[model samples]
Target chain A: MRLRNLGFVLLFVAGFAHADTAPFDLSDAEHIKAGHKRFNKTCAAYCHGFQGSGGRAPALNAPDGLPPEQMFTVITEGRRGAEVMPPWGTSFTPEQIWELIAYIQSLRSTAPAAP
Target chain B: MRLLESIRTSLLSLIATASLAATAAAPSIDQAGSADPTNWPQYHRSYNAWRYSPLEQIDKSNVKHLKVAWIHQPGNITHGLQATPIEIDGVLYYISADNNVWAIQADTGTTLWHYVPKLDPIVKEVFYGSASRGVTVGLGKVFLGTLDGRFIALDQKTGKALWSTQLTDQRNEAGALFSSPPQLAGNVLFGGTTGGDQPTIGKIFAVDAETGARLWTFEIPKDDLKSWPGESRKTAGSSAWMPGTYDPVSDTIYIGTSNAAPDYHPYSRLGNNLYSATVLALDPKTGKIKWHRQEVENDSWDFDSAYEALLLKRDGQDLLVHLNKGGFVYVLEKNTGKIQNVWRYAENLNWTDGIDKKTGKLINPVRPEVEKSKLLCPNLLGARSWNHGAYNPKTGLWYTHGMEVCNYITSAPEEPGPKPINALTLGLEEIRLTDPPGKKADGWFGAFDPITGAQKWKIRYDMPGLCSTLTTSTGLVFTGDMRGNLYAYDGDDGKTLWQFNAGSACRGGPISYSVNGKQYIVIPTGLGSHAPGFLAGAFPGIKDLPGGATLIAFTLE
Candidate 1:
């Protein structure tokens, strides 16, 4: 009975941990497409160049220095002293912001590898 | 019988004297339109805003021999120079991009005096962002509207402060500030504000030309709009950001009003936002609206129809020729808001099918219900920006610059916070996601016949033609482009007769004047501006553009 109770506790812990981890499918075509649309619609052309080249805003096609989580934070809350990059916490939802990060990551992978 | 005769003579004398006083108070339309050939006293070089000079010593035949006479380098200005220097009595007076007034010698390009306004840090940060277009000379003083909402008067000869009065509320939190030059009409100094980017309503202020006292104010109507529902009315913006044209004969001021606020989102401001993107004819002294014609209603695109309304007397009828951001040239009856005719000036206009001639309404296609992306031509940068077009009476043609571009724009949610980090207007976002990007945006400097709606002649360029034009009676047209090339075009055929690379983009209006029998053409050149930066992406060839402000004058060598 003690062993059975311990098994149940372990199962509960595993479920909680799984729930905490966001279920982001990096390889999913639909997820990537949604992100591409959002990024292109909101991010590109005005500040960023047509193909993520530098403009009034910086280039984002190259590899990002920050990790996915940090980028998510930056896109969601925006960094202090950065007036140009407005906080998208209210402009976009959490899922959409995460998707944008995934799209940005895809841009890096799709870009020609550095010489 | 003797007493009665004396009384009647006194009454007749009084009547005659009053008539003389009224006539002297205001210069006739003919006098204002064609000022002394040596003086560019007003913003457009005249009250008619024709931007055409009669000095023709450097005619089509001699224009090829033009060479740089002198270069006035205004070092401290960190932005582009937009001033078309007003030459008065051999002295050239203008303002810098940052609202610093400079009085210089018209002959030698020597800086006589520079007056910089001392403003609080907050005011400087919020209000004075764009370039000052030009300055006004009137009532023995040079009038300059500052970014801190003050209309200041300076001694025309000494550049010393005469009087300074606040035109806007000192506690302005929504960033309403002056962007254009002030116009002196009769005894009043007229100017308008530019705060469409912020949450403020646009207003035009009339200040006393002599004392700099606020005389009358005209606020753009925001209430009782059936289109914009409730709260959006508060954010309605119809800023008169350009110096208007005046007709003393009609006793009317033709002021062009800018787009509505929160530029992109139309759901927030629903109704045909009246007077936001309209041309208003007003009484200069009383601020009463005589008539108004809105060019673009419920402006979703940032198409401000606030360019100078070129007033022309066509076939004995007062006709106002206006080119709007949406790429449409509207010919209206100047006295009445009657649309005489309309034509598509730009080649790639797709935002509307056509204009309803009877109602003066844009025939815009039905917007998608779900707010998907819609492709439109002549994007927010506009087919024609703030660059002034010159009308040549001799050639009977209008010389202007035009752009060809399209935008895939989608509506986003209105920005939530009052002071978002990116305080840019929200709702519509331009997307570059369209497959097979349409032809790269190109530019054209062309002469169009307003009556026929036809392009008579044009010189095409890979880089966008982004500058004002000046036409002279000598059959030579002067214009500049984003690539820093100023061209003297043959006014008849639009052929580039001579070109000079000014080492910077020439965005300011070109003016011509003769000082001591030497005809000189002044072109303001500077590299810094959003138009050039965006065009750099559109045209890959424009690179290594030099920075700083320069006023280059040319004369026949």
Candidate 2:
């Protein structure tokens, strides 16, 4: 009876830790930080501008929010109509690319909020 | 005995006097002030095409004290100005966007004369727009190529048109006479650009310099059957967009041509597609092909071999070095078109395993297969694009800004529907962002040994695109990045010597000249082309970058 009780206690602790550690919802800060890091690594400083306010590339943080999946598609699949945007799917990993999408989404609310 | 001795003395005196006069009248090519190193008289400064200026007044020590002297902004966007201005007698002559030829004062940036052509409206619609690379000044005239298939000679002193003749007949829809400046070698030698979706032909014309009469026209594709084969000419629309280099010593003019039209599909055009994406050496006086070497065979990626073929002599042998959009640098014996060496200076290429040295043919087995994405290196822009490369003879180093990246190409299905205007069929599947193995991620200005095709040194940037290379006699190589910062590097070591923030991306090549013994470096800075549009957004520091076109000139204080 004592051994069985000890096993139950250990199982309860393990389940609690698993639930806490799982990535459920990323905060706005986390998303912004993730996006900013990827942009620096991939886009550099001339096309998108220093602050994502748009220079050569289009403004990413407009009021009309970019769909997260569409943003992912654009960055991964690329748009060939006019602007020669090279697709980034082969160069970057899927998880990292998704992080970029999350970060672009975070910019929608705070980009013009303070300015 | 006295009479004979006096005669010998008189003879010696006469010989010495004649030698002195000959030396005074014609100075050697190396002596300063004889040729006036301060004045950039021709495209590459001299007939030898050495971009190096002998002026050393603006050395490394005083270059840091340089300040802006003047700025001339022509607010128009056709194609960002690519022509390096030719300076003659303190006046600078250059072609601006929209085919306007402007003569500006080299010292003050004052506009002296502006010549604009009245082009046909219908012809202009199908054309790739109009822009002048520069004007060739010879025989007391300024020569320029017009947008609507015409070549005009204007008086250098005045902007008035001296004579105008059709280089290509637009009525027959031959092709557009675009930006490549007409090179004059006693005769006006020019080429045409046509790779549009329409069925047009490309030809190089040598017209009489004085009367503007056709001297000779060499059809690029030597296939006789294709000249009038059945319904259409087989070798139609192989454009030669860039200006050809003239070798007066050898009596040859070398021209590099663009790719076959409908650029995505190569199978439509059978055979190697001669002369398209090839470098042809022709007899300037006769317009006969001396020798020709194709850079890319059956080009499907729109890889035009239209960049300048910089002529140089290395190791006591004359060599013609040409850079292709396919990321390969080919060095050929200028006399025979025999390729001496080939090297892949840019990494991340997967199109071909290697080029055969003996045959000068690419060993590309992975032909364009539909649906399967074939990743190719150098992308459509190639390793180097239309920007002019600078050669510094003192160091024997060729400086060029090179792109190091790859793209995935999948052939698009062709439909008979109204071809979308400006429809580029080659779809870029993905951009390989990582720097090639063992190299830095960003683009670089590389100094290469032209003879051996070995990179002497490279100065890498934090950006992907850079303007053309500019070298000065002060041991400096000047280039700019997409982030608006102009850099002057040590031509010997690729070290950053000086930098100036132009507040926008610099699209044109830089030039250095002197006024009143004061040396100045001029660069056209403003909004130009940029790749990977998210670059500014990815780096928040440059988001509100300034966008205004200005010709920034700097001089030593």
Candidate 3:
């Protein structure tokens, strides 16, 4: 009986966690500027290149970047196995994470036109 | 019919016994202190970490006739096989990326067995810490330090798991994985983890090789926690990430330590971080420090002293030669960690006005500031990367690769962290590669008088050569480069003897050994490390350089 109740609790938690979009305005200009500063200090110096174009790690501005829901999940709780990346849940606040998402979207929009 | 069967069984038993006796005739790796001409028994070929083979069968005259005998391709080339292969009896053993162990015939590239470790599914540290440098073979068992936090021993004969020991918590500490092979010191084998770049204070542990029991643990950071201010000591890093060499004469294990936390920014960690960027001589039995020497006091440039220590005896004095990534070579007394001499090795050092040659006192060293970009000479690629250089007693010269490059670094303050574990607190806003003061960015491979800092002969490379240099008794020097070309030079005067393009970057160490009277040259070829990616902006061709994982063995035709 307890196992069944626990399974239901897990299902309920999963349902609320999967969101279609971020809580804040990812299209906001100020949000992206704040995130650009954060990304440069942490991510851009080494792993992901400046503007998240790519370095040792994958490019965040690629055309097929992760969706809003998946991006939130990966950033909140790091993903391992083939997709290997560290979690950022404990480091940043929920509001700050949303700002990073906005900056990532901006990078994609500002990427150069292909030949 | 029964009598005939009994006679045949007896004959088979006799043959098996004879084979055992014949193999025993050889000086087993565990019994012998150093690697003989026929076998490469240890990580740096021996406890001293010389990376040199005394075999003279293949010399400069006949090295041109050398041909590729065989090639073994490991299918899982995730980050590329960056291990130096080891040989015992007639079997060659190597650990590829993700801790996959393979045993192949030393003469031919026949695969005998392969051990693939099932790592934790949730650990994200495997990508940057992918390549397993090599494996330890002794006590009739092969030992591997995994990407996750386990030290495992496998049956050397069949490549089966013998025992496993959980050393560190890879989940909590993301960068605390093992990228180097465990070095076996007598009955105990010691291993270190990579927490130098992360927040956790790094640790090194010694374990019993036979039973896989914990012996003792040694932490690189200070015990009193006085070096760091505030709560920074709780997470400040001083990683011990490389294998150390043993000195039987002094009965001590000498190992080097990496840089402090927040590699570039040093506000959090104030005083000279006692043990970071230092070398410690420890008691092998108790794992206690005997003597220690801090190479760089408060190293703010990521200049790790975490390279191998080459033991040598000069004028009846036991001395050790250690090269720091900060572009200087130090000679220390092996018995007691006394700095006998210090000389600059790389020419493009602008981090400091100059260092006192003998006393090693800094002369107006440049300090980084918040939000201000300071162009440091070594950069973090290091004036010299972690890959090793060769010291040949025969030629009386050290063959090494000196990278003449610089990086523009801008520092920024880190927010006070009770932050998440596995988070790197590198206080850097931007790090871009650029050329040095007067020269264009390039690499120089040369032969030099180690003690006097005199260059005998030098060769220039468009891009830096990243492989560990190897020297042999036959007066030949071998090293691999970024463009996949393996060049051999005359150890005496640095003349190009032979060269071969491997079609993939040769980023692993080259070794020499003999099997059944035929000498063999083996080098693991691959290129997927952070150095190549970090250096992409400076070198044009590196952006498109290919990567592969193959063990190529060469023998004279």
Q: Which candidate is the best by TM-score?
A: 3
TM-score of 2: 0.74
| Candidate 2 interface RMSD, angstroms, 1 decimal | 10.6
Please report the candidate that would top lDDT against the real structure. Answer: 3
| Over 4 Å off, model 1 | A1-52, A56-115, B1-33, B127-130, B169-173, B366-371, B420-422, B433-438, B540-544
**Candidate 3 residue lDDT tens string, B1-557:** 34643554456346434533453432222222233546787777765666778888899899998899999998766566678889865689998867889999989989999998888743442335567788988778999988787789999999999989988876556547788888876678897888777778788888999888999988888866567666665666788787787654456788999988788788767778878888889988999999888887777888888998877766677677899998988888878867778888888887787666556666787877778998898868788887788777677778888788888888766776454444566777777777887778998898887666788999889898888888887889999888889888998778888899988877778888877778999988877566776676566467567777888999999
Worst 10 residues of 3 chain B by lDDT: B25-34
lDDT at position A79, candidate 3: 53
Cα lDDT listed for each candidate:
0.72, 0.64, 0.76
Q: Candidate 2, which CAPRI tier?
A: incorrect
Candidate structures ordered by DockQ, highest first: 3, 1, 2
lDDT string for model 2 (B354-388, tens) is 78988988896355555566665656556665666
Candidate 1, lDDT over the whole model: 0.72
Better of 2 and 3 by DockQ: 3
Best by DockQ: 3
Candidate 3, A10-34: lDDT as tens digits: 6435433544557778999999998
